[model samples]
Target: MTEPDGFRRAAMQWLEKRPDSRVDYSWVSSFEYEGSRIPLMDRQRGIRKPAGFEAALAIRTTFTAAGKLPPYVDAIGDDGLQRYKYRGDDPQHPENIALRNAMKMGLPIIWFVGVAPGSYEPIFPVWVVGDDPEALQFALAVDEGQRFLRPDFGLDEDTRRWAEGRTKQRLHQRVFRSQVLLAYNGRCAICKIRHAELLDAAHIVADGRPNGHPVVPNGLSLCKIHHAAFDHQLLGIRPDLTIHIRQDVLEEVDGWMLKGGIQGVHDTRLAILPRNRLEHPDEHRLEERYVEFLAAPVA
Candidate 1:
């Protein structure tokens, strides 16, 4: 699906700030219910929202985040529809009922599955695109992305096509970027530039190299230019968390951008480390990848 429009996006940003909750689906039955939806204030404050299905959008979702694994979200039809089941055979399950009401009112639903580790919440927006509920009023949700309530839900295609089209490497790259961005707080580790679109999570070791996994410690948030430089060995990071510019790049004649941006900085402490030492870059991987950087052809 394409991303939510600007108005919706802006509203979502405002709604998400200081989110009231982490998203538990159980709150639906347990929390106060008015008009068959949680009160706006309570929903925003993260109160109880097991049956989130709010009449609006927030960072988590209109329904917000679902705890652990949602009991619903059971099946996807061959033609690209999401099938949500009620617990056991309870026809009047609160979740099922609320979903039916929303569908009847034609209100769209969005929710978070779970936040990936070291990342912010992910959103999965699905509407009642179909009406084949086994029991009356059983709700159906479909982004049909064959996907997640993740940061980049926009890339989701229908489950069938998505599964058919995406590769393991591409999936890893998208998920890895999100994880690295969260750990590094969405800035370039070297330049400390804060533009999110320009940021990249670079692998300390090359992708698919021996022992190179795309986990947080193995990734560094780098801007596009630095990512290229590091990949090409124009830049190197040491085991001790210092930056090194290859001598040729430093000494060769160059433009202002090359001088100030790339070649000028040498032996600087890696500018952006994760807040938690545990999430910081791995020295062992740094040691290994540095060897590859050193051996890179000096162009």
Candidate 2:
């Protein structure tokens, strides 16, 4: 296999060990080769081309302002493909040339999107398919499946809408999950469960609802069981940060799972929360969700 293909395979192997699909800066910067560490990304630049590569191997968007969303839009263009800005003001910059070279060679690279200040969600095997020097950007597609879709034949209107919506939704959920997990120290807010594999970032207000942006304050880190319970209205969190199990669930005469796992936590405040108050769940969104939970009919 070619070097890019080999690198992608290695990245996939590394990602397999990280079920949460989130990586710290350390992981992004480390890929060993012949006992020497080969960083997947540039330590000081957004576009990374390593020592021997003619094409860029990875690109990243950064989240610099604390408690603020990343500035990179990642929005689909008129051609129905996402475009990443070239590094700096000059399109002829060496790093930007590296990205253009990748596009010309049809090489696949990694895209590390910042989910937190120093944390990222990696999208690999991303092909740089188009270089718009006038726009100072390069077109990107996530996988092999999308790499073939060209700007010459843009997506139909309906298809473009669907693609845009789906892409945004998936990216939003990923970033939200990473940020929420980081804020809560990888522990479930309700049960304090620290298993990253079992945790999810539950939304307070459903997506597409008013003020339901996929943001840290609009999310809660919960384990699988509690996430299901929260989604099904079996559990709720009041605006005051108090936990509440549905009356029926609290009264259910089920076995240990229900007794200790769900019921035992009724009326208790959340076991874990972000140290920064700004990262706390939005009280208003919690109130709206809590009201819905209270009105849900018991089975």
Number of the top candidate by lDDT? 2
lDDT of 2 by residue, 45-138 (tens): 8888887778888898886433664455555677667789878679899999988888888877888878766778887767887777787777
lDDT of 1: 0.56
Worst 10 residues of 2 by lDDT: 64-73
Residue 251 displacement in candidate 1 (angstroms): 2.2
Q: What is the lDDT of residue 60 in candidate 2?
A: 86
The best candidate by TM-score is 2
Score candidate 2 by TM-score against the native.
0.82
Error of 1 at 201 (Å): 1.3
Worst 10 residues of 1 by lDDT: 58-67
How accurate locally, in lDDT, is each candidate?
A: 0.56, 0.80
Off by over 4 Å in 1: 1-119, 123-172
Give the per-residue lDDT of model 1 (tens digit) for 271-295. 8888878678888999998888888
TM-score of each: 0.53, 0.82
